[model samples]
Target: MPSIAGTYKHYKNENFDEYFSAVGVPYMGRKMMGLSSPQMDITVDGDQMTIKTSSLMRKVEYTFKLGEEYEEHMPDTVLKCVTKIQNDNEIITESVIPATGEKCGRHYLFTDDECVITLTHDKAKVPAKRYFKRVTS
Candidate 1:
């Protein structure tokens, strides 16, 4: 679970927060609905996680153990997500958003030095990449 915890720490870091906030973060980007441009905020405390978005269109909150499956709703969609380890250093999550039958995949790779999150939506055939620096404990 070190990798999962590391990924959370990376996202909670001050530098990563500043950088992500400065950029106009786009998940699905220009191809999707107008609601796709929401600003994202993630909060993690131990194994619990909550994701908040600025857009009034959609918001989500959930708690799950690592390697467990959970259901959540995003903007105009409902998703079933499973968090699993891709390798010793990566946490990979695949989500199925039920509304449009869209499947999205996310990979979180962690190292002593950095962390990177890559999100790919299979329906649109497009991907978005985001990186974070490890937060020192």
Candidate 2:
């Protein structure tokens, strides 16, 4: 996989609001989440990886080793998940909600200057994509 170690700022989203609604997020909250842009900082160190996402409302950090399970607290829920590197340029994370038996995942594909994130939930009709641009400073 590519070394996705940089700060990526959210630039655009496709189907995010609808995805949020399908996942039972309130209308007002979905609207707010859709409007605000977030920044994600990813660090790769040998077999370990750390990712931190920050926005106007919240900041969350997750660290895990490739092919290992870890506790992740997402914006809305907390779950145990395994993260894996794939396709030489992609990171895939999968989680299952025990209470609801719902499966969800995220795919992060990196290019030279951009990251495309696809969010998937088994209950939702389709996945949502969030695009981020590399920040050079």
Candidate 3:
């Protein structure tokens, strides 16, 4: 089985201010940062996974079987996601906002010692790319 466990560095240049801000904040009533480049570590075991960014922001942990649907709430956004194996070398996980139904597609590619994830919107517009170097300890 392909394992997805590593620290991933992400870069985002999407127009988040235009769309995310329009949705407004969840409880604080403050807008999210217009741009963010946060690094997160994702650990996947079986069909369960946890993605952590930091102490204050990382608290969500969800589990879902491959080809099954699940709900995920991250900070102020709520999304419905499905995990599937796109091919022998790649896993494709697509997420859609429950409120707006806007789709965000994510593709994870695993090689011998490297992992890459490309994130985009419904229109196939690239919003971010995350690169990870497998570590051994």
TM-scores, in order shown? 0.57, 0.93, 0.61
Distance from true position, residue 97, model 3, in Å? 0.8
Candidate 2, residues 65-116, lDDT tens digits: the string is 9999898875577787999888768999999876788999999999888899
- Tens digits of per-residue lDDT for model 1, 1-137: 34334222223222322232233335444223232334444445655555444445455456666667788765445688987656767767889877667677778676676666776665433455655665542
The segments of candidate 3 whose C-alpha lies over 4 angstroms from its true place after superposition are 1-60
- Tens-place lDDT per residue, model 3, 29-121, is 323332334455666677666555532333445556778888877666778898876555577888998877788877888766666766677
lDDT of each: 0.54, 0.88, 0.61
Shift in Å, residue 126, candidate 1: 3.3
Better of 1 and 3 by TM-score: 3
Which candidate number has the best TM-score?
2
Best by lDDT: 2
Candidate 3 has an lDDT of 0.61
- Error at 116, model 1, angstroms: 0.7
In model 3, where is the ten-residue run with the lowest total lDDT?
Answer: 27-36
Report the lDDT of model 1 for residue 14.
21
